[model samples]
Target: MPERELTFAQAVREALAEEMRRDSHVCIFGEDVAEAGTPFKVLSGLVEEFGGDRVVDTPISEAGFTGVAVGAAMTGMRPVVDIMFGDFLTLTMDQMVNQAAKVHYMSGGHWKVPMVMRTTLGATRRSAAQHSQSLHAWFSHVPGLKVVLPSTPYDAKGLLKTAIRDENPVVFFEDKMMYKLKGPVPEEEYTIPLGVAEVKREGDDITIVATSSMVQVGLGAATLLEKEGISAEVIDPRTTWPLDDKTLIESAKKTSRVIVLDEGYGRYGVTAELAAVIAEGAFYDLDAPVKRMGAMHVPIPFSPPLEDVTVATEETVFEAARQLCGKT
Candidate 1:
């Protein structure tokens, strides 16, 4: 299959189109998703293609539409519910956490809520504190829910296809800042299994584990570190929960130095989980204390300068890698 260049949003739209075509049971519902095509326009023309029945536009009530999606999934339909912003996920916790996530387990595997909750995260769009936030950590802590954070176009498309087919409910998070970022994607069909981690770059001096948009930052840091005689390995844990521990633990054991990066708040966030995993699985191979970098513990500010300081950047990740490698 030949690969073509596609922006992150295009890749996601392609996945949804292909999945909806392949499965009659698959449907989508969200605010401004049908005719309006969403704020990012990722769903533009999809409603025209699949018609209003499959591609639906719901009201502004997150909890109400989310419950409807869950109910639809329970009845053997695969519903893709799109939350316009990550912050709005808090409003649908009852439907998501208490209902959708528990139905399969509570029913003793007799029923399954094979649903996909797609939402956007990160700050920099100036959407302000309410619209811009990375809350994947909150969902990752919940059992019976699969958390997916795709950083690249290829992963975004493939992982989403897999999520739509999953028996358990999946929380799919797309970085809002990466919508226009382009990467090569195959025209042919593919599905990247959950719980698999990818090594974006390989080295031996230090290991850098990053999630979502921070994967790109980690890559940038690795490129700069290379010129300074430091070889940094970069890993992207595509799925937050049920993380591919083998890949991360092996990398940490090989490099003996690790730095975990995330766009979420640093305190008690995804970085903390990765750091703990590395420390527990590869303690004997440690060379230096594991470092973590993420957004500060505060609501993302509306000011460009203030918001810029809150999130992790390539420079911050590079500096963290330098200090860990003793090159600073």
Candidate 2:
């Protein structure tokens, strides 16, 4: 029998549905999340299955609803707040950073904020600056929050399940452009633990450490590099906060050359932190300094051609890796 496949959106929906069925506390809160199924239609039919009480929709108030979700989680509810766009995370910073993140710690470990906030990231969607920001690194910087970046449909399903059941606050960022991207997923219920890194491809010449949407970018670059006799390893740090630094450092040690790729800005971004980690962990073993590639540090443009150049691509990564490996 052929392995079943699911799009990234479908996988997310399945995870939410299964969790809701298993636990009545697992509810959804966001704008148009109930009947409209969200802007991307990823939540279609969920409200019907779970009903309005569970898959509840609220007014277009991110800060307001996020505060409600935090309170709900603290009071024995596993609430999932959908923030639509990752850029809107700014509005909920106080609730997330000041409240939800510190509730358990401030309460001497008595209070728990088991909440999940789902949002979309990535550029090149033509959504312009306001809607097209990849800001996962912002949440990763917070100590009490777990930041999840699922690169594939399988990862999307498993990691989401884990996030919903986590004991701490979890911020889940999805690439809006990848909702329809398809990949094999198991029918059995399973959850991928946070903080684990998956080595998608193995190689000896160089290591490409990528997160979220950039995982595919790294894979594509690996394929291109293969033709040039450059064996590039691709590793996906599924969660940025509880990052699998050991795996990333080991890969850097083996390859001796490293490239950290992400959709966020390079400076003070996920790419910079990962590069630093690899440099610190594997400095003696490395042959070259770690390289960082990310979105251009500018407001993502509305123009198609200009926006396309802001983020890393397979060709760009291929060229960078080739040069780092002295292929040129």
Instruction: Give the least accurate 10-residue stretch of model 2, judged by summed lDDT.
Output: 319-328
> What is the per-residue lDDT of model 2 for residues 1-328, given as tens digits with 9 covering 90 to 100?
8999999999999999999999999999999998999989999999999899999999999999999999999999999999999999999999999999999999999999999999999999999999999999899999899999999999999999999999999999999999999999999989999999999999998999999899999999999999999899999999998999999999999999999999999989999999999999999999998999989999999999999999999999999998899878
Q: Which stretches of candidate 2 lie over 4 Å from their true place?
A: none
lDDT of the candidates, in the order given: 0.94, 0.96
How big is the RMSD of model 2? 0.6
**Residue pairs of candidate 1 with colliding backbone atoms:** none
lDDT measured at residue 289 in model 2 versus the true structure, 0 to 100: 89
User: Model 2, 96: alpha-carbon shift in Å?
Assistant: 0.4
Model 2 TM = 0.99
> Highest TM-score: which candidate?
2
Residue by residue across 49-105, what tens digits does model 1's lDDT show? 999999988889999999999999999899999999999999999999999989988
